[model samples]
Target: MSTEQVEVLVVGAGQAGVAMSEHLGTAGVPHLVLERDRIAERWRTGRWDSLVANGPAWHDRFPNMEFGEVDPDGFAAKDQVADYFADYAQKISAPIRCGVAVTSVRRNSGRPGFTIETSEGTVEARFVVAATGPFQIPVIPPIVPDSAGLTQIHSSSYRNSAQLPEGGVLVVGAGSSGVQIADELRASGRDVYLSVGPHDRPPRSYRGRDFCWWLGVLGLWDLETPPAGAEHVTIAVSGAHGGRTVDFRELAAAGITLVGRTAGHRDGVLTFETDLAANIAAGDASYLALLREADEYVDRNGLDLPAEPEAHLLGPDPACVTDPLVELDLAAAGVTSIVWATGFTTDYGWLQVDAFDEHGRPAHRRGVSTEPGVYFVGLPWLSRRGSSFIWGVWHDAKHIADHIVTQRGYLAYRAPRPPQ
Candidate 1:
């Protein structure tokens, strides 16, 4: 393989990777970004055609550049998001090596950096910022067997409601993706069965403002995340479907059968627990707790704003509280498709360094790894609740860039001179 060297090697070209590059460039750090495909691969390939960002465009801008004349209240399409990242890369002149896939990474035992093996060449980087991106590994049930006639697809691979076989769709998760897809299929006149899980179901807009506004105003964004109980619970926000809250109550009301956690599948019989009500209650409890905290904050600050927020937060729809479907016979019930929106995982096995814990997760401090110059970007719970979001990545990228520059003595650095 050929050889290349850079002061920093960024392992992705998504929003996070582009943001990292931009920040590093602003800090005058010499770096090159390596992308397996091209910029915005996830936006182009990972999402469905109708998928819109769960957050509005205004909240997802690049550092120092507010969304240019775009509707702040409107959620962006996948292509729109991809365009934003592309624009950011061009505006900052981010040095990207597209079509270069990082096969493996190892510490240069003799040097203070890393040796990253890629598709095109070997890169020796003083600092390796892994922004490999999310939805890395789709988590599916270990027990799913190959049924002769049924078609199954994980949410990661699912493009739309029309991709699956014509029959009832068993959507195995009640998070944003699952509900959105379920609603899509339901709207298409397909019978949808939603496997309920614990989730937070705050309204999309509360008190004449987006719920995100309340989160910002209440300092929930400041939360050091993987926030105790919220580590596993998904925030069920649906920007597609008119930016409304994807409440389980509404789903149940629409004739979607809400079942409990999938116990397993055996002999054409799919088993689910009787804990659907419990899961819904758990989410409502958390939702109420969040509202209580926000209420206290507003009261203490004398911010006498909207009175409707209390109503929105306190009111629980009776439809959401429901009995669980204990089990369903897949063959008899005519459930021909199963979509697992079970979430994602990552594999750091390619990294030769000991950057992982017993659980095989990257060990890092606010994007900075304990393993010297090796860092991570776009990791959930990296520093704040927003770390995985576009807004949160900015903070983490800024910190990572600052640390790399300050520690490696790059602050007084200058941009490379143009070719004569």
Candidate 2:
């Protein structure tokens, strides 16, 4: 196939791609964005039906637009979030081609940039930006052997409780997705057993402010690395039920069983560690530590935020945590389905470049790769703690766009100027 040429080529058309396109357009850089599916395809399909933005609508949006007339504190539905990106792309007049999948990306030895092979055709570009987000590949651990005969699904494919087999569900992983799925399943009258893991529990709201606000003001969001001892900790906050603190004990009281980390499964029987109590205590400690930091910040600044005394009090441990069930027979528990919310990892198999590290992850300094003309955007902690979401992606995209312009000896074009 004949190859088309462009100044820049961007892969993926989600929030990151669209944001990058917007900045690139402002910088007068000729670029084309390629998407394998429709715009915002992940939000429209990868997420569960009841899924909502983990961040509030006010804070989850790009700086150029608000989330319509929705309440700022409320969570926007998954479809709404998708539409937001689609609309943003349109508003910015992004040069995007949906249904175009990038098959391979390689350094063009004969040229100064990359040779991008796409489903439509090949493209030679002076620069390339891999704007694919972090959640590329869903990770489902092989804890449950195939002989178990239980229907298995990843949280990414889960739609609603009605989609599962007519029985209990064993949700492995207690991060945001796991807890939300478990909560929804139990509310739909399905027995749910959530596997507890190392997680950080943050209140949805405290002191008349959202926990996200606290993180922002306390500078937690800007930290390049997680706090000491919080490494690899999954946050257990939820936007469901009008936004509420995720208390596994409360979930237990509501008839959902909370189990410790899953060890292994054989012949339809699952085994768990006897560390449920420790996991709960660890979450509580993180919660209290966050509150203490916020309290100290308040005292230092002499802010008028009211103290939330109840937040500091820990209620009695639930039976599931104290005397946890270490073994569970899937058939006995009536669990016919299993939802693995373990998490995701990036996939750069298509990119045959030296831009990755030994671990197969993109190695870059604030989105600028060591390889010239190779840039990455939208990976978590790529620049700051807020590097993945809509707001953060915008800033990261601008930084990348600026870097691209500066590298090419073009003057940086700031926004708020009339389009040429």
Candidate 3:
């Protein structure tokens, strides 16, 4: 029945949590970070075996910590990233209590704080910062049919093709993970059907450099997302020979049958809308717009950057959809496996608060939660588009730390440090 109290509680231990802890430490604030598993647990168990970061290691680290002395432009694989986070945790001596699953967070009536009940015990937190990184649970469509007898998997649990049953694979979602997994499966001689949706189609390299380089110089990360929709995005990056891209066009060209977004499913038959052309066009438009933005940025900055190169791997042409698949008979198509690359949604089920919206997402202006003494970090568009990224969430961490110190009078309770 062990219980403790802390001035602040950060509810995760990934990059966001670790970085937030570092910021608190720098502010001389005594905070405890609790995680259900080890630090970077999501990166360890959530990703596939062949997954690599969408961006380079040189630019992916948090403030004051460098990915130091590594390949400046190389993409780190899954294990490498896990190691990186482990190393970062070690470097800062982050105050993280592993294997502590927080099961409840309720308001306290006597004071401005939260009563957090965890697997280990309980925490009385003056201010609660929820850094519960993205992808709380796999977002499978409500329309998914009874895949009774078939081996089904969400992309998060899928490791490699060898683990799948010997038959065709139907991958739903055309995002990075979907595309990459489908491509890999197809390469390994499995007949793969990739269901497409509106996805960003940025090239692997724009000029003579990786597209990430251009994104930094173009000031795009600082721009506001349009009100209509989310900014075009994908982490379908690779570090193979000259780099492998996770483009739908490339996937289509590589013999993976392209289908439209999953509409619904009934009696082993999956229905799809026939809008493949429109989705492909939307992706192409985003890419072209990005290139134009980069070109204008180069001209404005007077930077001597090279011109954009020739067509990369047959850009997504709508003409590829001549024989599109509208309804797929799962059994007849020999689809023994269905990998739901659908996406993810955050879960605040245990956080007993009324701060969430209709979509079950926490309503926050920046990182400040609608509920007092509570805050959210590492969410898409939290402060900017990049706020969801490892390198971007630091901005919110610092802001939250400052807010706690200034608004909550948290720095008043910081414990004195011993002589170093």
- Backbone clash pairs for candidate 3 read none
Give stretches of model 2 more than 4 Å off.
228-231, 410-420
The C-alpha TM-scores of every prediction are 0.92, 0.95, 0.91
Residue 23 error, candidate 2, Å: 1.1
Cα lDDT of model 2 by residue, 1-420, tens digit: 688999999999999999999999999989999999989899999999889888899888999899995699999999999999999999999999999989999997765788888888889998999998989999999888766788999999999988887999999999999999999999999999999999999888889989989989988778886567765679899888778999988999999999999998877789999888889998999899988988999899999998889989888998888889999998988999999999998888888899988888788999999788899999888888888668999999999999988877743445587888
- lDDT order, best first, reads 2, 1, 3
Q: lDDT at 152 for candidate 3?
A: 80
Best by TM-score: 2
After superposition, which runs of candidate 1 have C-alpha atoms over 4 Å from their true positions? 302-304, 313-321, 410-420
RMSD (Å) per prediction? 4.7, 4.7, 4.6
lDDT-best of 2 and 3: 2
Candidate 3: TM-score?
A: 0.91
- lDDT, candidate 3, 1-39, per-residue tens: 766989899999988898898889889888999999988
Per-candidate Cα lDDT values, in order, are: 0.81, 0.90, 0.80
Best by lDDT: 2
